[model samples]
Target: MKPIEITDIDVSYGAKKILEAITFHADAGEILGIVGPNGSGKTTLLKAMTRIVARDNGEIRLDDRDLDSLGHRELARRVAVVPQDISIGFDYSVRDVVMMGRHPYIGRFASETARDVEICDHAMHLANVAALAGASVHDISGGERQRVLIARALAQEPTILLLDEATSNLDVSHQVEILNIIRDLAGEITVVSVFHDLNLAAYYCDRLLLLKDRKVYAAGAPGAVLTRENIREIFGMEMLVKPHPLTGKPYVLPVYMHQSSAGANRRVHVVCGGGTGSDILHLLHAAGFTVTCGVLNVLDTDYGTAMHLGLPCVAEPPFHGITPESLSGLRKCLESADAVIVTAMPIGKGNLDNLRVLLDYPAKPVLFYARDHSTRMEDCTGGEAGAVLANLEARGALRVEGAEELLARLSRDGSDRD
Candidate 1:
């Protein structure tokens, strides 16, 4: 199988240009993903590869042969496309629909040969659609239809498979199943897909080409292409990029509107570490409270989440105990806050100073989340942490069962303050 090279391609509708100087190569046996905001010409670029949309200028070549020079049948034999929308006017059995992929090799007046039937059957099984072979396409679910279409493309036996949002209609399990199939076939058949779900693209694609304003914004591996800065610039939205726990690939989460009028004047300071503060910070920020967190290690997950949320944070260096300067900063935040929350997090010598700060701020309304304090103490610094927590409890600090109750208490406190 040879690569499909697109060079300096330009496509326009009358005077309106959709793509310009779009250059990239779909190497043999690699999955290249196209990702960008809507109207960035993802679909148009795919159309140019299959010659479905004429390029006003530039060349698209398949194995050094110009796509324009290849006859229809020859092109179809080498390239198979699964469009984003699949609309069938007539009700056809799944097997019959898959057989359509063998059209390039069949004569107009001839019927499918035994080998064609064999290929179709194998394709259906590979797509996990063998059970649906006898069912009418109109009677199946959207996800099942998507798999059926993929089977048809597989039956084509083309060197290159182009999918435009192929998994967009499927449920979570079906999406995973389809992507698993595509990932398995990637090294044997070149797969070029456009994906709206950045995480899925990052997981499955060998390389990514990001588009913006009808031009290449970035092109490289997923890590290089899908950065916090790049996504913000291209999509005009704030997103947090984290690694997938299982695959360790880049996963993106968009920041949604969570501001609340009820919490407009409330200020809360959180003393948490070891990832326990992340959910509390998120909840407070969403509820419209001015939230600040302090004395967290620089590399802690809580610090990272606070940074992503644009919250004020007082962080010390990684692997270091809290310093006097950081403690002073934390004290300032506590002085300005109307309430304080201490999440149930494992304490060590490095963060034991945080508990001491809570004990000192006995006059302020403090909510101690003690549900997991025992478990957290058992993991680290049990003696010192348990003693300090007892001191804070004796100093009139309120005890809350969990985050939900803490939120309710905070709401009541805010009302009382008002």
Candidate 2:
């Protein structure tokens, strides 16, 4: 059953309606993620629920009781809110700040009891900030401080916990740590968190609320809320949604704009594997380098990346064997190109022919970016291409150190030819 509910809630700042009758609920033991682009009123919703922003209309209820009906102590005992930002106007010990969470239980004109102290200590330990307990709040890192605030909320032992972009400023590791911690607290507390990281929300949240045009555009399980069309419409950008490799959750990958080539005339064949080939194709298109590739098997990350960019890619079906016909197509692409690039993908049985095709085409200068070492070559393929690349280096095939160097040389040389 839902532990907290927002019913047609509206809030206004002077003449502006910050929230437009927003409504949603948090089920008991469920992690609900509210995700939206910046200025989408995510923080405003959190504030409205806490009664920090007086709702101009509608009602908020907690476990069947209207939030407006609850007294300060009653609300404090039931709901714990970790605001988007916490400013320590005056320096205070971490322990003292966490102890503030025990305010609802304290008797008037009385000090903290042993039980309160124990709860504070446990909260500090749970947040992994026990060592910082005695330190001043101003002296800690932003992530640490955020954890401290969360710990304080946990100490409150509320039935519902609200977090506003709690992991926004933290690094990847810390974000994961905090997310895992929130996920672990699932059965004990109904967590409603505002998340800017769509990927993280997809992985962790049981349900997601995608906000757009001042209302809930979609709300359901992460998979439902994070579809390709929903993301494009709401976020105002094109993206590829795939399943996470590890967790099987929906993964959001934003598509970027590619610059088209200045001239419509020349086709440049790119020999790319892995993700290294994507940038080259993009730059080539911007500079009007007619780009085509062969031997990149379907399901290869590089192939998928290329297809995502709308490049004319000749992809072979995935298999243990690379067909001769595919090799012929690759050779044809090479022959048609005014220039070629051999991105550092390891030579293997499936793609050794791709490297051999480059070696065979000595007429065109092949810019080999040695980004990946020979050891990265997963396909043994008799070690012939590795030797061939070394031989080509000795024989004057250009060997560049990085992608940038390759692009700089290409832009200059291609400009001169035009």
TM-scores, one per candidate = 0.86, 0.82
State the weakest 10-residue window (summed lDDT) of model 1: 370-379
Each model's lDDT comes to 0.88, 0.81
The worst-scoring run of ten residues by lDDT in candidate 2 lies at: 370-379
TM-score, prediction 2: 0.82
Task: Please give the distance, in angstroms, between residue 38's alpha carbon in candidate 2 and its true position after superposition.
Answer: 0.9
User: Taking the tens digit of each residue's C-alpha lDDT, what string does model 2 give over 12-99?
Assistant: 8899878897989888999999999887888888888888889889889997899989999999998998865578999998998899
lDDT of 2 at 127: 83
Q: What is the overall TM-score of model 1 with all chains considered together?
A: 0.86
Best by lDDT: 1
lDDT, candidate 2, at 41: 85
- Which candidate ranks first by TM-score, i.e. highest? 1
Judge candidate 1 at residue 417 and give its lDDT: 70
